[model samples]
Structures are given as C-alpha cells and as structure tokens.
Target: MKRYAKAVWHGSGKDGSGHLTTQSEALEKNNYSFTSRFTSTAGTNPEELLAAAHAGCFTMKLSFVLDEAGYYPERLETTAYISFENGAITASRLFVAGIVKGISLVDFEACVLEAKVDCPVSMALNIAITTEASLTD
Candidate 1:
C-alpha cells in the first residue's frame, strides 16, 4: 500500500512559510516556516514530522512483534530523534521504553531490535537507525 501527505510553500528562504496536511487529516493546515525549521518556533518541521513517523511506525511494529511472540503489551513508548546537518539526515535514533507482559528482558530487547529493523518507516529511511529499548516495571 501507499500513503501520502501534502505540503505547500510560498515566499523566500529565511522568511517563507508553508502548511502541511495528511490524507487522514491528522495534520490539517499545520503551519511551518524557516524559523520553525531552524529554530524552536511554533508549528512543525520536516524533522519533527519524520521523528513522529518513525516513533509511530516503531511503536506499531513493536506491538505486532509482541503479539506474534505470545506476549501482551500494555504500552510501548517510542521516541525518534532525527538529526539533520550539512543538508543531510545524519541519523534516526529510536528510544523505546515498553510496559509489556509475559516477556523477559532479553526477549523483549530482541523483539525491539527486530521491530526497529523491520518497520516499514525504518526500512525506508536512508539514514542510520539505532534503538535503545527496555521494559519498565
């Protein structure tokens, strides 16, 4: 299957502005601009969205992996950190902390690695991806 989003931009580089929207309306007319991209301004940027996508994808993938492994999950919290430098994406770091049932630490770590590597978003991103996952009591 294929998924898509829309982005529209106008004006010049340092002072320009844009908005984004997804097919599902998850982001409707979300505003973004040069300041938002480079600094800690309001609204969203590409890196923020990329991080969200990675986090969401990894979380879902982990749920699937846990279910398939005969484990029930209460929560899987994932945070994705994407670094952009020198006009390129350097890396995407995935920090996952889960509250799962009926799984050992070793097994859960392995499953987290599998999800990190096998998730569609992780596989599609052309950047270094790393995961640090743990189970919380």
Candidate 2:
C-alpha cells in the first residue's frame, strides 16, 4: 500500500506560503508558512505532522507488541518530539504511558523498546530515536 500527500508552495523560501493536502483529505489545503515553521505562528508544519505520525505509529506498534506479549493495555498514550536542527531532523523522542493489567514495569518498558525500534516510521526515519516509557496503574 502506498500513501501520498501533496504540497503546493509559492514565492521564495522565506516569504513563500504553502498548503498541504493528503490523499485521505484529512488535511485539505492546510496552510503553512515560513513563520509558522520557524516561529510560534498559528499553522501546521512538516515537523508537527511528522511528530503526529511517529506518535501514532509508535503507539499502534506498542499495542501490537503488548498483545503478543500477553498484555492488554487499557489505555496507551504517546508523545513524539521531533527535533529539527541545522536544516534537518536530528532526533525523535518518544514518551509513552500505558495502563496494562498484570504487566510489570520492566516488561512494559521492554515492549516499548521493541515497538520503538520496529515501528515503520521509526525504521524509516534516519535520525536518532529514543523512548521513555512508563506503566501506570
């Protein structure tokens, strides 16, 4: 299966504005600009989208890993922090919290590690990927 998104940009890099659209149309001509990317402007940027993808992918992969390890999570939450430096992405840090019955914290952490390394998005990204996981009652 293949997924695709489209970006349309106009003008110079610093002064240009763009809109993004996904195949699913979840983002239909969403706006992005230099200020939105470089400063605290109200718009979406590529890093933000990538972070969302990473977080979603990691959490889903963790759920599968937990299931395979015989642990059913009542809830799982993950936040992916993408760091962009020197005009490139430097790292993705994942913070995850899960509530799963009958699972030790150590085991939960192991599962998180496995998912962190095995998620498609993590594998696709060339930057450093680190994770911090906690098991919550």
Candidate 3:
C-alpha cells in the first residue's frame, strides 16, 4: 500500500528545472521550474499536485462516509486550494458540492466534515484544513 514518485532536478534552485514522474505514470516526466512555481508559467508544481491529491482524497473519502451513513451520492465535486507562505504550506481549503438522493443538507455536511478530517491526505498534512460543502439537488 505504498506509493512513490520521482523528481529529477538540474542546476540551481532559482535557475533550475525539474521533472516529476509518478509510480502510476499519471504525471510522467512533467516539467516544473521556478517560474512555473512562483509565476504564471504553464507547468506543474508540488503545491498544485498536492491540491489535486487532497481534493481527490477528500472526495473519495466523502463517498465512503456517505455510503457508511446509508446514503449514495449521485455526484461529488471538490476543489482543494493549498496555501503556501514563508516557504511553508499554511493551509488547505476544500470546496465541495454533492448531489445525493434522500439526504439532508446537515447530514451531507457532517459527512463532508468527517471526510475532511479522516481522509488520508488530510490526516497526513500538518496544516490547517477547512471545508465548505454544499448539498445540491
């Protein structure tokens, strides 16, 4: 149950560039550079990847939580915003929307809160994690 990724960097930090490859090949040799990370350059960065991971993890966990609560979701969408400050990750904010049949908004929010805290990625992070969840019709 272990996952791994590889990063290969060249040159100095500011002037250097790197490529990342994941075990699943989902990000095979994706380029990342200082400009890509610090500016609006079109490339992938660690924070972006972490955000995707968090969103995916949280959504999946929410699905499980809903199932355990005897509710099946028709759809779930989540976006994770990762905040970086002072060379550290400060927070992860999750915005989620779910469409489930026969579930109250309060119950859906409770499931979202449980998933936000119980997800693997959320538990692994040592930063603030907040969620804004909405149950849709």
Q: State in Å the error of residue 57, model 1.
A: 0.6
Residues 54-137 of candidate 2: C-alpha lDDT, one tens digit per residue:
999999999999999998999999999999999999999999999999999899999999999999999999999999988888
Q: Any runs in candidate 2 off by more than 4 Å, and if so which?
A: none
Q: What is the C-alpha lDDT profile of model 1 across 1-137, one tens digit per residue?
A: 76779999999977889999999998999999999999899989999999999999899999999999999999889989999999888899999998987788999999999998899999999899998988898
Clashes of 3: 0
lDDT computed for candidate 2: 0.96
Per-model lDDT? 0.92, 0.96, 0.95
The estimated TM-scores of all candidates read: 0.96, 0.98, 0.98
Error of 2 at 84 (Å): 0.8
Candidate 3: worst-modelled 10 consecutive residues by lDDT: 128-137
List, residue by residue over 24-113, the lDDT tens digit for candidate 3. 999999999999999999889999999999999999999999999999999999999999999999999999999999998899999999
In the order shown, the candidates' Cα RMSDs to the true structure are 0.9, 0.7, 0.7
Q: Which parts of model 1 are misplaced by more than 4 Å?
A: none
